[model samples]
Target: MTTIAVVGGGISGLVAAYRLRTRLGPDARIVVLEESGRFGGKLRTVPIADGPVDVGAEAFIARRPEVPALLAELGLTDQVENPSSARPLIWAGGRLHPLPAGTLMGIPATSGSLAGLVDVDTVARIDAEPSVPLHWDRGADVSVAALVGSRFGEQVVRRSVDPLLGGVYSGLADTASVRATVPALAAALDAGATSLTEAVGRALPPPSDAPVFGTLRGGYGVLLDALAAASGAEFHAHTAGASLRRSGCRWEVDPVGEVDGVIVAVPADRAATLLAEAVPAAATQAGRIPLASSVVVALALPKEAALPDNSGILVATGEDLAAKAFTLSARKWPHLGAREVTLARASFGRFGDAAIVDADDDQLITLARADLATVSGVTDQPVAAVVQRWHGGLPQYRAGHLEIVAELEAAIAGVDGLEVAGAMLHGVGVPACVQSATTAATRLLATVAG
Candidate 1:
């Protein structure tokens, strides 16, 4: 009988197990080992005010085919829900400004787009940016702050870029790599776009009528449950300290025993430990990647609590606020809005500044409410609240990240019966994780089935 072991029961691990089961038949033994007490890693959903609310990832890039296709395969097409037309606001300079348009991930294509968000001198500098000669070494990577701060000034980096990047990676532009975080902008620079302004203009995706994001109506829990059931794999929750060692042509997974194939899908650090004995080179490269911790405070307020008409509020770097951002859930999602309670989420902590994530639930919730009141003037006390702390929630894509990923992947590819998939490699979004898992499963199948 063909047997396979999947380490870590996160979305990546579960997806790989599911893909393996669909191909390897009912007789195959698929073992899923999760160190945590639960299956979902960073993608968790909990009950709040008698309804399921996603405390981790709330949505996926709708344009990405991986998630939508996965939904179809799992017969979860009806669970899909799109956000409302309400846009988001950026809180900067002690006020809320409309999120700049004509920009690629907050790197404005023109100064006009960031008029109110930045100062006059900063705007003038941006206006004059096109005339300035850029010195981008082709294929060389630098921090997003280094590139944008040099051309557009620190104001753009703090006010615009940091907020967007912080929301996505729980990181700031100072540490995020331009190539890995915003590849299209880097590609434009590599292709000799002449200046930062030109590169942003060239990299800005064409406007599309389709929604940019989507989420499951009952929260990501619905999808996770469906995947768990359809995979039909033996799940070992709260199982830890599993190690991998080469066993002839197969692989030996501690606690799970020997298996035809294995997929290590935990965080970078955990993955490093598991692969240390079997593939030292891969472990070395994986260990170099760092992770950021964060806290999410979900509040269920009375329906009368007034929030801004916008979808959410993003706080600029250095803002006098404990929370980095807030998702006015009721305003953002139409289905969430229809509920009896007005739901909102306050996100706290960022890379290199995660000490606040360790705060007590009451303290975090207090800060969340105070920040919400300051931003939207909704001071009403919450009817119900939940705090979720994700230690090592997101992996940082620092400068030269792609190179590290390349080296790690190369080392893993040389070893038979071993594969890896997670947020540490490639993009950090759910769609990217799905793609990585699918690729790993396909490659592992090719090696084991032959």
Candidate 2:
């Protein structure tokens, strides 16, 4: 029988083990070691009202086939639910402005459409972007702030793009790689499109009435629980694998027994420590990947709080608040609304901003409440509240991130029976992690078959 060790119990690690079982059959013995006591690293659900609410990742981009397909495979397709409200408002210039239609990651297809969100001068600068000659090719990659700010203006990046991108990456636009974050815009620029407007229009997928994102009717925890139950891998919670070494043909997990193969699925920092002896180059590179800390506060309000009708509000930089974004949970998801209770969530801590995340749970909730009240004018005390702090939660993809990832992968390839998979290595969302894990599992299976 072939035995494999997976060093992490997050969704990515679990998915890899599950895939390995399906491919290698019952003869394979899979062991999953999680450093933490609980599973679902970022897919947590907190009890609120009559049901549970996702306090971590609330939804996944449905356009990505991996998550939906996985859900279908797990017999969870019937519970897939779309957001009741898709529109999001951006807080800027002392008021809330609806994120304009026809924008890709807040890069407007038509700059004129952004008039409501930014100042007149910014709009004028954007209008002149078409006259600026195209200088980049498809192969070129640059920071989102550099490309969009140079073409449109700094105000556009600070006011519009930064908040939207920040909500996703927990990182600033000036440092994030455009190619890695918004590939469609990068591809358009790389194609040598003369105008940003035309490039976006050409690059964006055709309009669709289908929901852009989907989540389980109950919570993501439902799907995660199902996956964990189906995996059949021996789970060792709170067992952190310390190092890796090779034992002739098999791989050895330090302080633990040996396995035929090993998957290092923890965060980059932890993975680096484990792989340092076996794959020094990859370990060094992984250690250098930046990570960000974040906090989320979930508030259950009285039914009459009168929250904003939009899905959420993304806070623009320079806003006099600690919060980076706010999601009116009950308004956004109809299922939450069905409970006859108002729900809201506030997010804090950006890539370079970590101090706020260190606050105690009470302080964090107070901050969230203050911001929520300021933006939505709902000052009533919450019926219940939950605070979740994630240290080194999000991985930052700096400019040249793709190149860095390629080098890391190449370095790991030299080590037989060793594979690395996680959000830190690829995209950040649930679907992206699933895709990365699936690829890693396939590669490992190929080695066995060979």
Candidate 3:
């Protein structure tokens, strides 16, 4: 039996190993090495007074079909449910506004529902903004905020884009690169249709029955557990990988002990130290890929809280609090849950901004409380609040990001029988990470076969 060592037992590594097992039949021996004691990495769904609440990614975007399809393939389809039955809030221009419809890339595609969303001058500029042509070099990289702001206006970036995209990338617009983050936006712009209006119009998928976003009935942890089970991958929790070096055609991965044919899927910084000898240049690029630390405060409130119905609230930066965004977990997926059990998630810190990551637990709860009260109108103290600190959660794919990623891949090729996976390359979402897992595993298998 051929042996493959899968490093990092996060969802990405587990999924990759699972696919490899499925593809290689029973003959392939797979082992997963996780630097942390836990296997889920960023995935955590803890029990609160009301029920379980996710501390990591809460929902999978609707347009991404692979995640839902994969859930079904893994027998986890029944676990999936839409995130919300109510409108979400976006904080901008000193107030929270209902996320306007017919908007894409922070630009409103139509004006009917956006009346009170923007100021008069900003509204007129947005109205007259000729479907600004999105002209970007295919091979080069650009900032998502810069691209969006340039095409629509700065207001769009400050008002619309920052609130939603900020939560996903968990980074500033200037630092968040387009190709590494939202490639579709870059692609649409390159295809030449002035303005996100035309770009989104042309790029929008044909209407389908796909739900907007879905979370697991039990929480995303179910999917993580399912992946581990399917992979039959053994993980050493609480173990920290010190380094990795390539010897001959095989790689030596040190995560407590040396393992053969290793795949390093940890953060880019760790990847740098691990792959330094085997792929020095790639290690350099990996080290250069900046990562941001963040803290997630999951506050569970009783259903009888003093607040109107809202799916969730996203707090913009420079607000009364430091949090970038928060989600009303219970409101988003009530069918799978109960009204008395509202799960509010407030995430702090983005790429290069680690102020909140080191904040004490009490501070986290306090900030979360104030933000919830200001944004959601729920001033009642949460019955239960758990703080999860991810030292390096989100990677900032700055402008010119794709070029470096390509260089890193090339450097990885110097060492054989190795592959990279996870958010460092693709994104911080569940779907994109899964997509990277599948794609990278396929390439790894083919490399080994060749």
Candidate 4:
């Protein structure tokens, strides 16, 4: 009987273990070792005013087929729903501005759409951009900020790009890789397009009536619970994996016993620590992947509170604000079953911005409330609030990140009975994590068959 051990009980790890069981049949033994007491790493859903709300990742990109496909397999296709409101406001210049329409990651199709949002000089720079010949860096990856700023000017990158990307990855656009973070833009650059706006327009998938993202009616917790119940793998929560070693043809998870195969699905740093003795080269490559921490403050406000009109407000980098972004949860996801009170979530911290995240819950909440008061004119205290601090929560994909990932994958593949899958490997979204898990499971199956 072949038994496989999966470290880290995140969505990636759970999905990998479940998929592996599907392939290896009922006879095979599987175990999931999670360091924390909970199963979902970042897929946290908690109760608020008699309804469930997502404190962490709430939705998955609909374009990515992995998650939607999985939902269907789990009989949750009917539960899929889009956000109630898609419009997001940008809080800049001490006011809220409508996010320019038909923009790709803040790079507007034309400067004409950015009239009052940007200053006259920035607009002038943008108007002159079409005439400016683009010096494309053909082969190598560059920062998204550099690529976009060179063509669109610094204001666009700082105001539009930084906030959007920062909201998703808690990373700075100036340091995030165009190839890894903005693949379409990178592809356009690689293809030698004269105009970035034109290139982005060409590369972007044709606009569809369907929403770009989807979420469950209850919360992501429903999906997580479903996956957990179905996986059937012996789960050992709070069982941290200290080290990994190989014994003959089988792999061993330290302090957790041995198995026929192993899948490591933890964060990059912890993954490096686990792989130290088994695969040093892979460990070295893993350690190089930079990570960022963040804090999310979920606030349940009274019905009378003046929430913004749009689904959320994104805070630009230059703005004097502690919150990086704010989500109008009640306005956005109506399927959570509305109550009398309005629910909102505020995000704080970004790459190299950890003071807020490092603070205690009370201090973090106060900071969040302060930012809320500054933006929305809400002086009344929240009815209730929950603070979640994620240490080393997000991975920063710097320039040449894909190359590093490829090298790491190659190095890890050299060792038999070992595989890795997580957010850092392919993408940062839930769909991408599922895709990575599927890939890892497929590889592990091949190993067992061999």
Candidate 5:
């Protein structure tokens, strides 16, 4: 019987095991090794108040077909829940402003889109951005701050771009790469767009009535449970220190024994350690990627607590607030809003500013409440609160991230019966992880079959 060992029991590893099971049949032996007791990685759900609340990733991009298709295949289509039509607000200049429309990840295509958010001078600079000659090399990469700040001014980068990038990447624009973080804009630039404004205009996705994001009604735990059951793989939790080596024609994963194939699906740093002996070149490239830590404080207030109608509030860079962003759960999701409690999540920490993540639970919760009160004036004490800290939770896609991934993948391809998959390779969202795992499994299967 064919045997396979999957290192890391996160969603990527779980999905890869499930795909291998479906393709290799029930007779095959699949083993999953996770150093942590839980399997979801950053996709965690905890009990807060009377229902499940996601302290980790709260939602997935609905436009990405990978998640929707996976849900359908797993009979989880009914679990999909969409947010309300309420928009989000940007907290800048000590006030809340409407989230600018017609922007690609907060990079406005036109000056008017950012009218109320930025100052008159910044807006004027954006308006005249097209007239300024841009010197973007076709395939060169730079930080989002450098790209957007040069073209639109520092106000645009701090007030407009940083908040959105912080929410998605857990990092500031200065650390994120234009090619990796905002590929559409990079593609437009590569296609010979004359100016940054023109590139943003071309990169902005067409208007669509479809919901931009969605989440499972029962929380991500439901999906994790489903994937675990469908995979039919033996799981070993709290199982760390496993090493990989070649055993002639097969691979030997210590403690898991010999297997026909192996998948290293951990974080970039962990993947580097695992692949050090088997694929040194790949390991070297993987080690170059860095990670960021973050903390999330979920607050459950009385149903009558008065909050803004907006979905959430993003803090601009240089804000005095301790929290970076807050998702008004009760105001954002209709299903969540119907509950008896008002829920809100305050997120703290960024790429370089993650020292705050190590704070004690009580201190973090206190800071969360203080920041929440400062932003929305909803000082009602939360009846229940939950704090979750993720160390090295998100991989920072720094400039030249694409080139690093390309070299890593190229090295892995030269090896046989071995593959790697995780958030470090392509995109970091759930959809991207799913796509990466599916591709890894398919390719590994092809190699093993040959």
Candidate 6:
């Protein structure tokens, strides 16, 4: 039997073990090590007085194939639910406005697409006559905010991108890397888009039957529980890896004990310590990728309450409130609700914005209540509230992030029977983690077989 140790019980590690079990037969003994007491690192489903809530990743994108397909493999397809039909509102221009059609991720390719959301002056600036030219050469990495403001105009960032992406990444659009965060749009611009009005006319995929978002019936935890069952790997909770080193031919995983064939998948900061002793170069490079903290506050309101249908709202920079972003938890997936339970969630924490992360549970709820009351127009107080703090949650993919990842990948290649995988390694979302895991697992298994 081939023996392998999978570190970090997050989506990637568990998926790696599960895929390995399916591919190499059940004879192979797969051992998974998790630093925390819980198996699913980020995929957590918290319970409310009436219904369940998702404090971590609220939903997965349907356009991204990996997670949805993976869920089906775990027999979770029947459980998948799409976002509600009602439109989502962005808190901008001092009030909520219905997001216009044909604008994806807040980037409006057409001037007319700004209707209902943006003012006329902003719309006229998007016209091709006075379009400004960006000097970014091919393959040059820049900020997503810069690309949108320079090519699409500043209102595009404030009106669309700010509310849409700000809700997810929790950072200024310009600060987030164009290549790392939204590469497809960046590619279109790099292909010689003088302006968004010009670029959008080129024609892309007409929206598909699949909605923008999806969630498991039982919250993200359904997929986590399935991964636990499918991956026949030995499990350890609350065991933090001290340091890692390479022996003569085999690698030594010293998490207060010696083990072989270690896969370090913790956050970049935590991974830095293990990789430093095992592969010094990787440690040095990993440390350069900084991680920030975030907080999510789950609120369940009365079903009779008047609010937007099921879609949640995202906040812009320089907002009156401290929340990073939020969602209508029950609206995305009906499985989240009970007889009269109406669950909602909002996040706090962004670069240069740390209001809710440092606050206690009581203070956190107070901030959320005020924000929700103003934005959602709900007068009723929350029936239930839960605050979750994730230390080192946000991965900063600063400029030249890919170059650093390349350097980190190269350093680990020198070590025998060792590999790394996580959000920081590749893309930061669920799909990226799954894709990175598939790549690393194939390489590690092949190395062992050779």
Count of residue pairs whose backbone atoms collide, per candidate: 0, 2, 11, 0, 0, 1
Query: Per-residue lDDT tens digits of candidate 2, residues 150-243?
Result: 8888878888889988888888898689888888877776676778876887788898888998888889888878878888888899899977
Candidate 4 structure quality by residue, lDDT tens digits, 366-425: 988898888877776888888988889989999999988998899988888899999888
Whichever of 1 and 6 has more TM-score, that candidate is: 1
In model 6, the worst 10-residue window by lDDT is 196-205
lDDT of 1 at 351: 94
Candidate 3 C-alpha error for residue 343, in Å: 2.4
C-alpha RMSD (angstroms) for model 4: 1.4
Show model 1 residue runs off by greater than 4 Å.
none
CA lDDT, every model vs. true structure: 0.94, 0.86, 0.74, 0.85, 0.93, 0.75
Stretches of candidate 3 off by over 4 Å are: 25-27, 110-114, 131-139, 195-197, 207-209, 255-260, 336-340
Location of the lowest summed lDDT over 10 successive residues in candidate 5: 240-249
Q: What lDDT does candidate 3 reach at residue 434? A: 86
Query: lDDT per residue, candidate 6, 338-447, as tens digits?
Result: 43767788788876656557899999998888888888777677888889887777677766788889999999887768889888877878888888888777778777
TM-score of each: 0.99, 0.97, 0.92, 0.97, 0.99, 0.93
**Number of the top lDDT candidate:** 1
Off by over 4 Å in 2: 137-139
For model 6 the local lDDT of residue 123 reads 76
> Which residue segments of model 5 deviate by more than 4 Å?
none
- Give the per-residue lDDT digits (tens) of candidate 3, residues 6-114: 8788778888888888987776778787777688878888887756777887778867887888888898877877755578877765687888766654556655546
Which pairs clash in model 5? Answer: none
Residue range 1-450, candidate 5, lDDT tens digits: 999999999989999999999999999999999999899889999999989999999999999999999999899999999999999998999999999999998999999999988989999999899999999988789999999999999999999899999999899998899999999999999999999999998998989999999999999999999999999999999996379999999998989888999998999999989999999999999999999999999999999999899899999999899999999999999999988899999999999987899899999999999988888999998999999998989999999999999999999999899999989999999999999999999999998966
Better model by lDDT: candidate 2 vs candidate 4:
2
Residue 420 displacement in candidate 6 (angstroms): 1.3
